[model samples]
Target: MSTDTTTEPEDASLEDLLARVDDLETRLADLEATPDDSQKMVVVATKGTLDMAYPPLILASTAAAFGYDVTVFHTFWGLDILHEERSSALKLSSVGNPNVPVPNAIAALPGMDEVTTRLMRKRIAENDVATVEELVDLSIETGVDLQACQMTIDLLGYDEDDFFDGVTTGVGAASAFREMVEADVQLLV
Candidate 1:
């Protein structure tokens, strides 16, 4: 005679639990087989003004610090960001800037842009914020590749010598686009 005392429902529940465990194990194995997706970053700088220039540099350097390969492609007006003569002196515009306390009408007044630019620079200095030059240096030090847009340089009649010393190369839009498409994170700023 058999002495097994387990009920039919209890045995069925045990089988269900084992099946669920197997399903979960399979899922875990699939997850383990997947490759990492956090490798590259590409940033596009389209504007050259002081306010517009900081984002690409800051993000590229920060990503580099996190061990991601970083590239910043400068195009059009953004070419000034890589210009040796103007990178440090890019000015913040008060016109149409909602963050400024002054009304748009007042901000658009003559010389208001200069005033706002001076104020912004003073505030940045007071707060120990990194200037564009410093951020560019940091990005370069962290192995961020700075690229100038060749089409823009040619259109604007600027020579390679016009760019800062840290630029890795001058490339066309297609090259920059390729980098953007390949990057895990692509930012346009």
Candidate 2:
């Protein structure tokens, strides 16, 4: 004779199951009605050239305007973007940039970077586009968190006072990583 192994379900009545379902539905509806958390955006700015500086600032400012919590983590060359004096004096690299419209040979000339920067500044002025300094100011005013990497600061021999007024200097990479990990949108520029 074969052993009878089939077991009936636990004594869960229809009304009990329906009540549990109703409770779960109520909880789901309450959760659905709750407001969503704010979105977060993080950008890692690794370039300090005049041309390279715009993207992170622009994006950060725009995201802030859209009600996103925005952070721009400046590391390596990007630390210059937060430097009060250097930000304004950032120069466009004439060599190895395809958008410069100059051949690499010609762009490598001694004064070509200065010339390119001058021309670009002129074009920007003519077009009424904001300068790097102006964009940095705007980013600060718009509540974009500007974080300067601590290790880079030590390596480059930069003091905390070297950065702009609103910049958060001496931030470590691990802190930046935490922010990036929690960010809804992350970019490396």
- Report the number of the highest-TM-score candidate: 2
Task: Work out the TM-score per prediction.
Answer: 0.77, 0.81
- The Cα error of candidate 1 at residue 102, in Å, is 2.0
Question: What shift in Å separates residue 6 of candidate 1 from its native position after superposition?
Answer: 42
**1-91 per-residue lDDT for model 2 (tens digits):** 4334322233346667888999999999998899668899999999988888999999999999999999999999999999988998899
Candidate 2 segments exceeding 4 Å error: 1-36
Poorest 10 consecutive residues of model 1 by lDDT?
A: 1-10
* Predictions in order: lDDT: 0.88, 0.91
Residues 1-189 of candidate 1 have per-residue lDDT tens digits of 543555677898999999999999999899889966569999989998988998899889989989899989998889898888888779888988899999999998999988999999999999999989888888888899999988888988888998878796558888888988889999888
Q: State the lDDT at 94 in candidate 1.
A: 92
Model 1 lDDT, residue 146, Cα = 94
With a 3 Å backbone cut-off (N, CA, C), the pairs that clash in candidate 1 are: none
